[model samples]
Target: MIKHELAKLVEIAAREAQSKDLIPPTALPEVSVERPQNPEHGDYASTMALKLARAARMNPMVIASAIVSSFPPIPGVEDITVVAPGFINFRLTDNWLREQVPVILGAGASYGSLDIGKGQRVQIEFVSANPTGPLHVGNGRGAMLGNALANILAAAGYSVEKEYYVNDAGSQIEVFSNSLHARYLQALGKDVAFPESGYGGQYMIEVGQELATEYGEKYLDQPSQLGAIGLERMLDMIRVDLANLGVVFDSWFRESSIYKEGKYQAIMDLLKEKGYVAEREGALWFTSTSLGDDKDNVLVRTTGVPTYFAADAAYHYDKLAERGFDRAINIWGADHLGHVSRLKAALTGMGIDHQRLNVIIMQLVTLKRGAEAVRLSKRTGDIITLREVLEEVGADACRFFFLSRSADSQMDFDLELAKQQSNENPVYYVQYAHARIASILDLAKDRDIDFSDGDVSLLATEAELELIRQMILLPEVIEMSAHNLEPHHLPHYAQELAAAFHSFYTVCRVVSEDIPMTKARLKLVQATKIGLARTLALMGMTVPESM
Candidate 1:
């Protein structure tokens, strides 16, 4: 809403300048209204004058003064000042900001929901970890990021579908199946050499035991032939593990199913129709270089099996065309960074709009226990599971920690810090603030106070205003997070809002002997609770009424 107001101001100034013949009609510079990093620069600042000065070939100060004089008084603007270097600053009325308290409370949970997405269908596919073992720490980061992004997009008015792409057709599944069979043979006291590339995690032993219990010694005699059935059973166990970790997939898209249903061949046919495929080296190759890939890619090997790229290309085609999604976002780990250009090339070569595909590469996460790092290797059965981390720090803290950092940056998961009972942990700090407000509100309710009839104007302290400002800007923050496809901003914004609320609680007396101010303070407190609750709810976390 503030951005809209600022855009209006810029347009008015641009028209006024054009009318005065100071600049040509078509030479009006693009104006940007940005919040200043420093509060002293006023609520919003525009550099239109500096931009127009270059085209007008005049002094920036003169242009700035002219624009300021031509500007009409806005209702919420306390004052408009022209600063040096042709920057026009606008200060907002404190009273107008304070009046937003009731508006926010009136909107309730729906206050921050915006229509920026315009009802476009968006599919966010993330944490599609191979159904081989329990989800490790690396997979948890993607899960939290994807789930939070989905919630943020929905709040910003997107028709969101959360999906998980299962790698049920890959060689990885063979390895998992062989591993289970080996574990079973070992459990039966048979002399069997474990496959060199097989998984060796202890969880596979459980899968083997479960298989033995279900069908005792039936599949063991036919190791090679039983792989298909064993793979299916192993995937079932993996699904159960993921559900236990609070990671649910709306669609478990099977890679093999895509190929089996002829979607893979259809995609190849479309690419050939678009003249993007060619035969080379006794294998079918995709000419991805034309679309900005580093080189051409192999779509099918000499063995006649389609490569992973072929399956992904077909999967994306189905997602975009047949599924009719307006956008598709893939949350991938850091190792997949090199695949971005190739995937984009594949989409482009297939005549699909490249803009429809958005790949977010989340940097790797390193988990530490105190000063020592936790080493994880699935082959050696030496990895930390997400379940273990969740058990240690808690789901709320684990989600908060993972969601707090940007996906582009590597994050250190400090087990010791997360497990601490002190305020050093950000999750506890924010939850404590919510609990503190609830405590105060409970106290007020017990005193038979009627806070519904309070005068919000009594909340005149700087800290109170700061808190109100944060609460009013909740929608804007959500909009930013959604547009950028980044949920890290949510936790950071929550912490800032909590800080403001805590400062207000410390300085403002909510249950004073003076009844008028006390009622007003109670109203402010209730509004804060509404905001904190909504903030936590946005991240899919519940605000405990009592902490």
Candidate 2:
């Protein structure tokens, strides 16, 4: 909000220059106010003068001076100055920074809420790992991204629905069933050849053993039924893994559900009627090149079986047409980036706007422990499960580490650093800041210090002001994350906020010898606590009252 106010001031200055014939009367450019990376420059900086100089036929320095002279008085701005290349820098008054404490205290958890979404219906489907095995660390990244995105969107005023699209009716499920069948036969002491494409995880063997224990050799001849039972058991495991990581889906949309409910066939028929589908070589083909795809895609193979693309496209159609969500977002691994455009094209062919369907391709994740690549799970398998890493570091640390990086960039999560209690671990550092502030607040309460009417004006130190500045940026962070559909900004912002609080704690003691200063700093500490808790909540992380 301070940034917007600064932009308005720049516009007013531009208008005054126009009235005085100092510049042309053309429409003004949108002013962008950015915080200078160097603290010496000031609180906010704008480069409008340089943008206007060419059109106005005047030196940017002269124009900046003219605008500065005509600038009207504003309450929070302590000082304004023009520097090299006609950049205007603004410094906030100490009173204004101090006033934010009560505002923050009063706002509490709802401080960062925005109305950008206007209650639009949004569905974020993520961590839809097949019902084959437990969730791996790669799928864990998508889990964190989707759940945090839903939280951010809800804070931005959208009606968000968290979904997990289960690929229950596909080759993956078939292979999983066969794998379980083989394991069951083996558990029955019958030799069987393993399917080369089947899952070889030890969990498959466990599922097979369970099946054998539950039903002996009854399912030996009914192997298809055995696979279906195994699928349900596998899904149960996946659900538990997700729940342990603080993720719960509002909907578990089954790929088979679309077909069972007739939605899939209806959508395919609609595509055919719209001439977007063609039958070639006894297979149903989607004319994707009709909407700018590189090649046409097959919807059904010659064997009369639908492709995974068909199920995915049908699922999206259900979200956009049958269920009627305004937006549908799918969090998929980067290995499926090639599937994005064709899916969007299919949506376009169905008379739905392609923009409504958003597929976020998450890059790969590599786990590391003390600089060594951790490729194998502690379990008897090569793939590391999400539950294993979560148990090693912690659910909070795992989620924080996954959300710390952009979904499009590959990230290496360090199991060693995540478990550290020192400030080297970012999650620990942020949580410790919350715990320290809580201790300070409790101390104030124990000392019988009355802070209801504390003099906020006493917070005049540079560290205190900087901390206040960072505290107020939470709303902006939410708004930016909502607009960009990226939640990585939250973890980085939390770290900076924690650093500001840490610096303030070092310089300005909250429970100090001076009672008046202590009460004022107590209010500041309480405000910081609110901010840190809100940041943690946004990322679905817990804020421990004590470390």
Candidate 3:
């Protein structure tokens, strides 16, 4: 919000300078206001003058000075100066920074909320991992990423829905069904051999045994019935695993439903009508090359079976047109990277804005025990399950570490480090800051120090002001994260905020004999607690009051 306000101020100053004939009457460019990396430069800096220098044919310093001279006085701005290399810097008053303590305290849990979205509808589909297998640590990355992004969008005032798209009608499901049936026959002591293309995870055997124990020979004559039972069991397992990782989808959209409801056929007809579909060698193609794709993609194979691309196009149409979400965000794994462009082209062929669909490709996650890489589950002999990681560390640590890196970057999850209880663990370190604040607040309460009317103006120490500075960045951080669709920023920002609080606590006494100073410091810590807790909550991590 401060950055926006400062950017507006710079625009106004530039226009005013233009009117005064101090600069050429060129059209105003987009203004950018960013924080100076160096502390001494100022709180916020702008390069509008430097950007205009080329067009105005004037020295950048002269332009900066002219703009600063014409800059209107805005509250909370302590000083505006023109630095070398044509940068206009604006510093916030320390009094204004300290004044935000009461504001943050007053806002409570809603401190970082912004209205940037204005209640637009957004549906985020993530971790739609096939029900054929258990979710591994890799799927956990996309799960946390989508959940956290939904939180950020909601905090920014968007109506958000988390969805899990069930690929229940695909080739993978058919294979899984065959595998389950084979195992079910084996469970009945039949001489059926396992399908070569069958799933090899031990969970499949358990499902088979459970099916045999539950329904016996009734399903031995019915492979479809056995497959349906196994599919339901696998979905139940996936749901429990996601719940353990702190992710719950608001909707479970079954891919089979589209065909059952005739939406899939409807989409195919629409694409054909739009001239985006063509028949080639008994196969139906999407003709994506018309939309600038390097090659055409198949909508249906020569075997008359529709491809996954065709099903996804129908699903997206349902999401944006029938369901009427303003935006649809899909969080997929790296393997689905090839689907991104074709899906967008499909949307375009459907008379929808391709920009409305955003697909984020989350890279792989490698689980480690100290320095050694651990890939397979000790129990299932498959990729290590997210449930196993959650059981070992916790939902909180899993969410924190899964969201620590950008979705585009591969990350190694250190199991031994996550299990640590000390400050060496980031989630522990951040939560400890909140716990420390709680103890300080308890100390104030025990001493009968009434901070209800704490004077924020008395908070002038560098540590106090620095802590306040970090506390107020929450709104900016939320806005930036929402704008960029990057939830990774929240975890990093939480760590920085916690570090600022720890630094403040080490140098300043909160329950000192000086009642006035103690009251002010207590209020500061209380504000920090609110901000730190909110950040952790947004990242889907638990904030411990005492640890």
User: Which candidate gets the maximum lDDT versus the true structure?
Assistant: 3
lDDT of 1 by residue, 1-547 (tens): 7766787788787789779875556566667787787889988889888888877888878887888877887877877888898888888788887788888778877878899999999999998877777778888889888988988998899999999888888677777778888987777767888888788888777767776777788887766455666666656756665565455677878898897899998998899988888999899999988887789999999889889989999999899988999999999999888888888888888778989999999999888888898876677777888888878878887778888889999988888887884246687778888898899888988998988888888778898888887887788789889989989888988899999988887888789899999988877777888888887877767588786
Q: What is the lDDT of residue 533 in candidate 1?
A: 83
**What digit string (tens of lDDT, one per residue) describes model 2 on residues 1-547?**
7888889888898899789877777666788888899989999988888888887777888888888877988899968999988998899888888899999989888888889999999999998887778888888889889999999999999999999888888777777778889999999999899888677888888889989999998998876799888888878888899888788899888898888998779889999999999998999999999899999999999999999999888888889988889998889888889999999999999999999988888998888778888774323356778888888777887788789889889987776776673235588899999999888878877888888888889989889999999998998899899999999999999999999999998887788789888888888888899999999998988889997
TM-score against truth, every candidate:
0.93, 0.94, 0.95
lDDT of 2 at 289: 99
Model 2 TM-score (2 dp) = 0.94
Alpha-carbon runs more than 4 Å astray in model 1: 22-26, 222-247, 370-373, 420-423
Computed on alpha carbons, the lDDT of every model, listed in order, comes to 0.82, 0.87, 0.89
lDDT of 3 by residue, 1-547 (tens): 7889999989999999999999898877899899898989889999998999998899999999999999778899977999889999989999889889999999999999999999999999999988888888888888899999999999999999999999899787777888889989999899998878678788888889988988888887777767887888889999998887778889999999999999999999999999999999999999999998888999999999999999999999999999999999999888788999999999999999999998888887788888989774423345668887788777777777788889989887777777774235588889999999999899888888889888989998888888888888999999999999999999889999999999988998889988888888888899999999899889988778798
For model 2, the local distance difference test gives 0.87
Give one clash count per candidate, in the order shown: 0, 0, 0
Q: What lDDT does model 3 reach?
A: 0.89
Query: RMSDs, each prediction?
Result: 2.4, 2.4, 2.2
Candidate number that wins on TM-score, 2 or 3: 3
Q: Candidate 2 regions off by >4 Å? A: 368-381, 413-423
